[model samples]
Target chain A: MSAALHRIDTLAPRAEASGTHIAIAGLTKTYKTRGGSVPSLKPIDLNISKGEFVAIVGPSGCGKSTLLKLVAGLLPATTGTITIGGVKVTQPPDGVGMVFQSPVLLPWRTVRDNVLLQVEMRGRPVAAYREAAARLLHTAGLDGFEERFPWELSGGMQQRAAICRALVHDPEVLLMDEPFGALDAMTREKMNAELQRIWYETRKTVLLITHSIPEAVFLADRVVVMSSRPGSIEAVYDIDLPRPRDLSVMGEGRFVRYTQEIRKHFFAQGDLDH
Target chain B: MTDTLLVQSTRANVLSKLMSMDAIRPLILVAVILVGWDLAVRLLRIPPYLIPAPTLVIEQVIAQWPMLLRETMPTLTATLGGFALSALVGIPLAMLIASSKTVESYLYPLLVFSQSVPKIAVAPLFVVWFGFGVLPKIISAFLLGVFPVVVSTVLAFKSVDKEMIDLARSMRAGGLRTFIRIRLPHALPGIFSGLKVAITLAVVGAVVGEFVGSNSGIGYVLQVANGNFDLPLMFAALFVLSMMGVILFMALDAIEHFLIPWHASRRPDPNSGT
Candidate 1:
């Protein structure tokens, strides 16, 4: 465990020296309505290195989701810019996959076909990705159920299929907005383990947004907390946790301390979410 | 062993009896209604011209079977033609309305107003414009049917989860790709339900067109039967019309079953599978 912690200690400087995968420079977002302009995010800056996993946790309405949307290029930044893989992201970049809170699987599609939807929408030849989709579903423990529809699966299984869908295109970065928020506590833990395994194997840069302090600390290499509305990064903490951490690690002293530390922000804010 | 077998046999007997009752309940209700009508006519000595007995209606169905069958063709043709035309025009119009706010603002109010104008009152104008051929009846059907398709499809398109589109955008799926791959399929269930309502109205519209001018079809037959005081024949024609409406609705329902089998409404009960 100490050896793993030492590796994480070495990670930050090396990543900075090499160059960051995602760079946000003074990014802000404002939504215009008849009522007037409402600021969602303040001018925020963060750098995520290649193959790093970062999680952001904040109170409800804090605009952590808005930050993810800006990074995903689903919404334009009001001022400043976001760069991914050394290119300015004007629209959705070519190599990012996203998962929302709901599974959002096409009801008409079989589990495997839903995963292949990413490839199909991108104008890729679907036949070429068939094996890859099957392999990804297998990794999510959805083997032999490829022909099943979304309604046939439990909520947890549906979310797993969604995760598989996000990975099917072999993206360079994965963005998740409370992907497991709808799941039960027990199922959520299992999914966290599954996600960590997937991330460990793929080594893609990931940014996860969640309300659960334990979830954010359990999965992310660095945990960034944001303040309430018109959100800006409040603090950033290097997890200093071991790689390939299991669910039991959540009970460990370091993990509990991290969760406690993150939970303090939400408690102070008196948000309704908790 | 004998006691257990005896209990099992009795349980099976009760189950089978209950199953048969469920299957034949609707037929039993129909039988009671028909019997009551026949008895009322005979006991009151009512004239057949005023109200035909159920037996007389049955006799008319048997005696004029060939003529009824032939006249059914034209009415069927008009209904089918109008339904097809409604779908063809309405779907594209719905897509236009869904895609652009300007188009929606211009078209939606007009469409709603058109629905408020009764098809029966407007159908005579169609007969004058298109002549007494099947075309006028088809146009009448189209008028009645088109409204539901537009309204339902628009709702479906509007109701599509914004997050799903965000997911598509994050994948760099183009506008057309997102519409065809995501929005279109997602709207299909609501579109189909609209089509079902349109079909029922189309039947009424076609009959109204025949009432206005046509010399063929079941509508024409109904008019001729009324002139001659053929109450039994009128009832038979009404039966055929009701049956046609039911069959058309069921056919659309079956298509929905095949088209979107994974939809929540279509899927068999989770426990029913066992």
Candidate 2:
């Protein structure tokens, strides 16, 4: 069992050598309220290449989620451009899937129906995706439970279903915003391992927003650290971790070093105590 | 053991459990109320014409069963018809109001003003305009039933989790698709609550219209019985109307159970074992 759990392979960084797949140039966001204009995200430029896993870590109230939303085109950038796969995003773009902090499943829908929601929302015939939905559910370890409601499942299971719903449409990029924030500590660690396996299999470009430094270092090939309020990228660290990462990897020296390095930024800003 | 025998034993166990004190408490209370009412009438020596005993009312109901059933049909039809009409009209209006602030601003005040006007007072005006027919009763019932549906539906649509909406938008789902797949299903429990309230109000609205001006219906019979000082017959009509309300409410409750058993409200309590 230990040998099987420790089976590992290197994740060759394909995106680093290739040209960018998602390019952001001087992106900014500001809210215009009655009082005045409040800047949310400062002008920033970043690029993510195809089949890469990138995680953005920041303090609470930072614009990490705002950046993800801008890239997904759920919210418009205040100034510059977000181009995905050579197409500039003016509105919600195609070939992108999103998983939120909450599972957000419709209570009326069964697990299979929730997964098929992607096809239904795209105006496609749901019957065509029945097999695909079943496959995704099986991959998520939710097989034989497709007819169950969201409320019938545990929190981790619900989040797994949410991930299946996002990926059922075969999108090129997956954007996740604190997807495991609601889980217990033990479940969160288990989910991180599960997510690593899914990422290795699917190889979809991913941009995840999270607050946990260790989580960012564990899942992401590149960790983009952001500062709070009027958020901007402070630094980017490239992770040299192996693929098929297990919970045991979190105990290694390099892993601690990476997490400590990210923690220093928050500690310096006096935000860590909170 | 045979599977059928095992199933039979389990079913019998469930039936016995249902007859336990917790399950039959409401029935016990109802019995006490009935006994008290009968004793009060006997002790006060109230004239039968003023306030007949429960036994007298029951006897009157059996003797006048044919007339009562005939009159009941019109009231039941009007009540159900008005409630259905409200659901059809009000839900769409709610969607419109939820979709745009301009529409909500224009319609909300008008809705509040209409609700503020006592429906009983409006019943006479409906009779004046539509004449002494079922149309006036239906209109009156509609007026009373629509408000709850509209208000609750709007609240339900607005209460949808923002993250759910964001997830849908990120997938490039169009507005209509989002509404059908996400918003409408999410709003169902709230809509059913409104429908439950509206259905009971519809019963009252139909009866009010009949009282104002009508040639048929139990409400009209009630007015005639009151004039002739036939207390038992009036009580019989009142009993039928209450039963209709209870029946409609239970029907909606059953539908809610079937449709959204995943909802927190429908989930069996862990401690209760039901």
TM-score of chain A of each: 0.94, 0.93
Every model: Cα RMSD to truth: 3.3, 5.0
TM-score of each: 0.92, 0.91
Per-residue alpha-carbon lDDT of candidate 2 for residues A37-145, written as tens digits (9 for 90 to 100): 9999998788888988999999988888889989988888889999999999998888988899999898888999989988888877888889988988998899888
Give the Å shift of residue B213 in candidate 2: 1.6
Task: Enumerate the candidates' DockQ scores in order.
Answer: 0.79, 0.70
* Residue lDDT tens for model 1, B123-142: 88887788889999999989
Off by over 4 Å in 1: A1-14, B1-28, B42-46, B271-274
Error of 2 at B142 (Å): 1.5
Question: On a 0 to 100 scale, what is the lDDT of residue B220 in model 1?
Answer: 93
Off by over 4 Å in 2: A1-16, A125-128, B1-18, B21-27, B258-261
